[model samples]
Target: MNRDSIFISHATPQDNEFSIWLTSRLEMLGYKVWIDKEGLLGGERFWVTIQQAIQSSAKVLFVYSKNIVTNEGILKQGIENEIEYAKSIALQFHIQDYIIPLHIDDSPYNLAIGLPNINHIPFNNNWAEGLKILKKKLEKDSIPQIFDTSKSVMAEWYENEYISNCSIIPKTELFYTSWWSVSDLPKEFYMYQFSNEVQAKAIRNSNQTIPVSLMSNVLSTFDAKLSFVVNRDDENIELKPVHTYIYSLNDILYGFESDKFPQHRDVENHFKRLLYRVVSNFLIYKGLWRNEMSNKRLAYFLPKYEKIKKIDFTYPYSNRKKSKSILGKFESIGMWHYAVSIQPMLFPFVGFSLKSHILFTSDGFKIIDDDKKQHSYRRKKGKRFFNEEWRDLLLAFLQRLKDDNEEIKIKVSQEGLVMKMKEWPEMFWSEVGYNDPNSKMDLDKIEDYYEEITEESND
Candidate 1:
């Protein structure tokens, strides 16, 4: 009749020995331990008995092993369902760490069920030490701290009466309108990087940096607003006033991935998790634009993706609404040809073939006309980019596979796909010559052509 039973949730037979030993050890520490082996009789309903044991137990200990992670048979043994029910009960009571994970093997953290980030108590190397740690944790029932607010009845009343009744309609409406306003862009930014060492020296000599207004003005040329700016720390040595610009990379990436169903929080979380892996010498420019960079010349340069080679640089003419049908089709077809000509330097995948064509829409690039068979080539929508950790891991892994054999295939993990952005270093800084405001490429003429195209299309 012990109500303080600690339930051991594990795969039977495989984990049978460990469960038996753990039960005995916990019982020795003055705890009532419940295992399916001892709790259920022959005639008992299997599910009802499990539910009752789980309900009666104060804590659920998930026993993790190598077998549990890889063996499908073990998962089919009904322990996953028990974990699910335990999670449900924990959620109902608003519990934290109600189900503790104990590890008996060195499986990857991501492999453990319902415990990706949680630090599990390791019993792999030293069982006695892990048991001691568990004993200490369970000494006081592991109750979460709750602040007593019995004397704050008036405080609660004030919040309920004033804050709850406050009208936030105007603020909420303003947010929606502001988002759409920034989102509506007439031109795409086509960024280009320059290691223009000559220009770098000139900036250093002048002891001056690009004006803060430069970024906004450049964005406005395309009728776009500032989205996210990743500043280079060492650039402060040169003191670029433009580096002061700061916005959430998470928000910008989510807007790119999905206009209909954006996972804002997920984007935020992944960026935060992988922020430390980013080196200090890089910058990212994100905003509402049809292209990655513009024809306007500028001083600052965006970082280049060192890994990718022969990226498709051309974009759809900004004023597509005004272009003649023949001209538009020609331009679009030209872009598709350019896209097909490019090849991935790091990951070799046959993308632009005879059957498939790359289409440049207003928002971003798409590879279509192949019955959606280009999943391997394109980044899945809603995935954030610039994951340094994942990229490093994948490259190393791929190289290892290549070393083993000439042609080998391996299953792609979620981490690999999540960091797979379609085209990285998507925008480059508007590169120009030293002391000359204009570059050798003549961006002004390019701009003029776009203007003329727009006018003709309008006519």
Candidate 2:
């Protein structure tokens, strides 16, 4: 037996030409549209057949016009009887949103008053184009899930090699999440985690939600500046960056430890390969692998090399220059005035250096020199900076989140109607605390917390 077809209920005997044209168009698009003139057969129990057709169809299309709505002859069969019967069948089966109205060259505004949110198609204005819109809306509204956008809404600027690698999802769901982009990166990459529907909508409407990439950049940027602003007194806590070392193999780096497990062996070999062309090294410690331990990290000497770069800057492109290591302060040396352009390569395992181009050696991402005498690392230049469009986009997004949070913290207070956040005893000697009288006692605790935070943040 054939499944029921999509029914087109219209005041059609008077408007027969339109019914033919409309049915023809729908048929071309492969919809088995049931027009009453073609559908009604002089058979046994015509009313039983009509009621069964109404119940089984996935969609009901009501084509409305000027004369048929008020005409008693048309209303008697199509609306007052047939369409009304279809709706009763829909209610019995608990079908929601089954009635879609296709409006014609009449008072379309007045015709659809007080009905449920009827999905209407503009048939009179542009016949083919209107049908296209109707078809898209019909297909989209039919889906069982929300955020089903059959039409293209996301921007194409985010469509390149970079986006494909990073997008956690395909096209963004419209009903699930609204467009809340701080950077021009595609909406497909952003989603608020939610345990339920209520929470999902709540986060979608909030300004506080921050992108993950932007958060990473802000922590990295602030680390450079806080180093200088903080070293005020001998009692004051001095911020020290957690030292990091990247092996040549792993894109991620490992800490200096003497373990000889398989994991450590992999990391050591990864970092060791950078040794060939990058920098000269001195031994920090020697390690023994695997005799007392499982087949873990291999035994090798950890090297102390020159710090080639200091990049303490925020998103929007700003950096700080500072030299830090055990050897430099004892020699009374200040930070080096290194060549500026090569600075970005100094990320990860930055060490102290007098030789120029040390930053490039660390992470210049070298290619063969072509003459084959040497391998030179790669550096971003010219359009490469502009091409960091993803990074820049990530920055702007984080700034919005930061700005919103700041606004939330600053509250208004009273006294002569003069508002101030400085109510914590104007001259009390300063330090970091929630309610403590002085900040002095908490400096060491704060420093330890800062170290832990930076470590976790870097990872």
Candidate 3:
């Protein structure tokens, strides 16, 4: 029997996914790895086999998580037995670093009783990054590898066990995207040349009123006339607007003939910046409150006003359909308000790409300013949302913005020009067969969380 094999000790079923993934990767690297996939049966013969395997192993990789221990600092019986046996073997053999702990979740290291004062490789945030560090440590420890024969064995095992579970079947699937297509847009682009730099600076400063892209003394916009009056020094200033140039949308999309913006990319970038401001202004006009992120980018969030408590929408779940509110109050973490950072895209499609964000508020009025706490709350609560949930949340938010005419229209110019988005674009793909088992589990948990919150709000 060879002592070159790497022994993997993990909590069964709960840590099986990570254990399997790690085993496959290590085996591919030509390291002989042993893992009991069926879990401990708790017999004398089983214990004897496990003890012999651990004793003859080069290093024992322990998968550490809350699954192997309780929140009250109690260790799992099977995991405790395995760790105790491995530690005894390490002491007898004088193995300096016998057990290498792989911390997969947010389980505190202090509570990991069996493996005390040992450094752990963090795989909580990113598995690939953790694997890189683990590989380097293995190489440093001079772990023996039988690359020639091990590769073939791993391929056969993977194909027989893993690939058997997945099947390639022909099916058509509809993918809901965050992209909302711009069906109609204004044709004309106006450049309002101010009298002096002072007037231009004032107009630039008050961008929320009339969205514009300022360059020197020139103010570029899609609107023919300014929506708000210009004032300076607490006095109304009568200013005359001199039209510099009226460029067509085609010129901005294709090429720019102007000397200032010579490059086509620069023209497109300028248009995108101006378009973002327009969309932000449109959201503000629609009564959505704006909150500026630390990066100086503005994110508009739905406020809990008297009229709007929750935005209702329907989404597919399991074999049936379900409806839920995109905005709600979670008892564990304040109010979860749906926020979006709209970015105007041109290459793939002429549309506004909405990036979803969650803003927290105590009473659904004032936003939580503690950045650290907000991040932690988002990680804890937002993890429950599956792809379907996120998609429907975005859909509901967009649906709420629609008028009675069933159109989301933004006024661009004073010349009655507007940009319209009828609805979200649904992309369909054929021959899709894969489905995530975890998503269904997550959806169930999230639904329960929603029910709990609803009950709390009622109380």
TM-score, one value per model: 0.29, 0.28, 0.72
Where does candidate 3 have its weakest 10-residue lDDT segment?
Answer: 439-448
**How well is each residue in 1-459 modelled by candidate 2, as lDDT tens digits?**
233457677664555445555554455444565555433221233566666777667677777676456643234344546567767766877767677777755444454343436656776544444566666665565522122223211212112312344434434221211112111111111112233444333322231222111111111110111221132254543333233222332222434455542245443333233221111111111110111111232211111244532222242122533222211111121221111111111122322111111111112222122321111111111112221322233222222223223321111111111111111101222233122112111111123433443343256
Q: What is the lDDT of residue 244 in candidate 3?
A: 54
The C-alpha RMSD in Å for every predicted model, in order, reads 28.0, 29.1, 9.3
Candidate 1: Cα lDDT at 407:
26
* Model 2 spans with C-alpha error above 4 angstroms: 1-4, 38-45, 71-74, 108-117, 142-459
Overlapping backbone residue pairs in candidate 2 total 21
For 1-459, candidate 3 gives per-residue lDDT tens digits of 457988999987677667766776677557788777446222233777788889779999999988987666688777888888888988987887889999988878876665659999987755555676787788799889765544555456556655555545567766776676778877776666777877876766665445687666767688766643567688876566654566777886677555563356655666777777777778888888988887787788877776445554444323544455656776755687878887788756777777888888887778888987676567556766667667777877777788888788887755557888756554555657555334211221223433443353356
- Candidate 1: list runs displaced more than 4 Å: 1-3, 38-45, 69-74, 140-459
Q: What C-alpha lDDT values do all the predictions have?
A: 0.39, 0.34, 0.71
Candidate 1 weakest ten by summed lDDT: 172-181
Q: Could you say which candidate leads in TM-score? A: 3
Order the candidates by TM-score, highest first — what do you get? 3, 1, 2
414: Cα error in model 1, Å: 75
The segments of candidate 3 whose C-alpha lies over 4 angstroms from its true place after superposition are 28-30, 40-45, 69-74, 106-114, 117-137, 145-168, 195-197, 204-208, 227-229, 233-236, 250-269, 284-310, 314-339, 356-390, 413-417, 426-459
| Comparing 2 and 3 on lDDT, the stronger one | 3
The per-candidate count of clashes, in order, stands at 14, 21, 1
